[model samples]
Target: MSEMRLYDAAGNRLYLNAEERAAFLAAARRQSARDRTLCETLHYTGCRASELLEITPARVDLSGGTVTLRSLKKRKDAKGSPRIVYRAVPVPPEYLDTLNTAHGLREAAKSRKKANAPIWPIGRVRLWQIVKRIMIEAGIPDAPHRSPKGLRHGFGINATVNGIPLHMVQKWMGHAQLSTTAIYADAVGREEQDIAARMWG
Candidate 1:
């Protein structure tokens, strides 16, 4: 059965630790620009793969230093129509520079028609392959968490560990409930230790 824990039902850790995340980023940077942006965007934003795929040039706000993503989970109203929700998450300036350089986002963003095009044109399965390949290249151990979802989980934990508010994490993650986002606050052992160390210091 599924649980509200970071680990899977089989007890596999579902999020990458700091060292693993850093390794994954190093490996990602060695790849081509397209793959690098895809990997880095996922790393920084912690958005789901499908949500990443939906992003167009217009979605990237270079000046504002944020990427707006369309949330995949459609909440229906009383009329049963799916509501489209969007969330904007901040990214680094260098990440924005690389994304603009790789995809010509600035020029594309100028036109409504051009801006609507997806940044990464590949499908979900192909996207999964790219991330998994990067994970292997990073030398992350073989486990249930060695996929894109792991990266997402890592973002949550990293934010929590670094002292971001849970409500803000929930907003950035586009979670429907604060309870869902609260799980990251229950980080284990080493992560807890890091937070404790800061307190003790």
Candidate 2:
């Protein structure tokens, strides 16, 4: 009958700007400490929603300032065997603090116990609902692709624009290929204007 439009029709600009990011985080924070940490984890680590849900308190290493994320994306080695990749993403101590507060556990306790305890303790559908609610509260207009995936893309593009090394971004993002991470380099933002000004001056 008719072609269905299941995705965004306006444009392919999936990355959120700094202001939008901040607004979304602010909205998330108002929801709960758990949500704030969840959104912060997504923003900082660029992990997929599934990976975020897979996070356990034991996976968080506060001393090392990193969280170990198990990649959910399907990957294959040269031998064509499936590979389960894990990445450790550096995060600020404040993000860990929120996590502790949400779970009501200290860092030491988190490390010594709760190996199987999920941090967010929510399913995929619930996580999506939380993200969509936060986006709405932040006044972000509804769109076909305006969801948690957009947050992940925004984190990647934001990192590239801020001059973070592409390889490092790829690792933090749990991307299988550097070429996939390189797409962030094509995102134009304030970084473009600043570079242009330096050249023009």
Candidate 3:
């Protein structure tokens, strides 16, 4: 891969700001239970849309307060066999509660058949549309950073701004290289300013 950038060639931002992120979550709440949890999962975990869709009931560890996501971007191992890399990202306990109430997660996980199946089970095209609709509902203007990728990038930046260690963000984002996670530290905006403010205080 060349590199991961938070901007396109035209210099439009490829990540949502703090306010936009909050708006997206607010709009996500207006969606149906399944869709709301889907959107919230993307927001909280910083996982790719495909990774979010790939999550199964068994992977949601309520007791552990984490969600195990298969890192789709990391495709192969050194020997060229398919590498199924799993990362357990910690999520808010409240999100877990909502997920359980909405999907009966604890119940589904008890059965082997239901545990292995994907939670969302929707195609990429449909999921994309749902995300786009939520963006509009959030009143986020048209921009390069208006899709699920934006949400993932936003999570990275948000975590960095909130003083979460860089290494932790790297693991949460499933970045193979720590350098890739460093990109979020380069993000500038009000959030960064707030971090700087603490120093001046």
Candidate 1 lDDT (Cα, whole model)? 0.92
Show model 3 residue runs off by greater than 4 Å.
75-81, 188-191, 194-201
Q: Per-residue lDDT of 20-105 in model 1, one digit per residue for the tens?
A: 89999999999999999999999999999999999999999999999999999877767988898899999999999999999999
Can you write out model 3's per-residue Cα lDDT over 1-201, one digit (the tens) per residue? 698999899988899988899999999998999889999999999999989889999999999999999898856788988887899999999999999999998899889999998999999888989999999999999999999999999999999988899999999999988999999988856457855786698
The list of candidate 1 runs beyond 4 A from truth reads 1-4, 78-80, 188-190, 194-201
Ranking by TM-score: 3, 1, 2
lDDT of each: 0.92, 0.79, 0.91
> 1 or 2: which has the higher lDDT?
1
Q: How big is the positional error of residue 84 in model 1, measured in Å on the Cα after superposition?
A: 0.9
In model 2, the Cα lDDT at residue 59 comes to 80
